[model samples]
Target: MASGALAKPQMRGLLAKRLRFHIVGAFIVAVGVACAYKFGVAEQRKKAYADFYRNYDSMKDFEEMRRAGIFQSTK
Candidate 1:
């Protein structure tokens, strides 16, 4: 009868310890995901933009725009 009365509280303490471990694991996973995104997706986007504009001609684009009458006056 005495052990039966103590069982619920003991079970709750064990569950609380397990819950702490789960919380820590979740935090570690979140940090890992954030790091992967920063070094993977974000870095790839920056490199792609750099590669795209590497051989671009701004003057040619401006001239084309002017010929198309997009600009009302020349600066």
Candidate 2:
């Protein structure tokens, strides 16, 4: 009977440890996924902005605006 009582506490301790490990592992996985998603979004935004600036019409408009003194230094 004493051994049975001891076994129960040991089993409970082991189960608690395992549960904590699983919770921590899940948290790590969630953080990794969030970081990957944020990195992908940043990369997509960078590429889109680069493409926008590379367009011929955009370049022409920029030049026209500059020549019209829109970007003149106020100093």
Most lDDT-accurate candidate: 1
The candidate that wins on TM-score is 1
* Tens digits of per-residue lDDT for model 2, 1-75: 455544445664798899899999999999999899878887889988998777659667878888888987621
Candidate 2 lDDT for residue 60: 78
Clashing pairs in 1: none
Worst 10 residues of 2 by lDDT: 1-10
Tens digits of lDDT, candidate 1, 1-75: 455554445664798899999999999999999999999999999999999899889999999999988998873
Model 1 Cα displacement at 56 (Å)? Answer: 1.3
In model 2, which runs have C-alpha deviations exceeding 4 angstroms? 1-9, 46-75
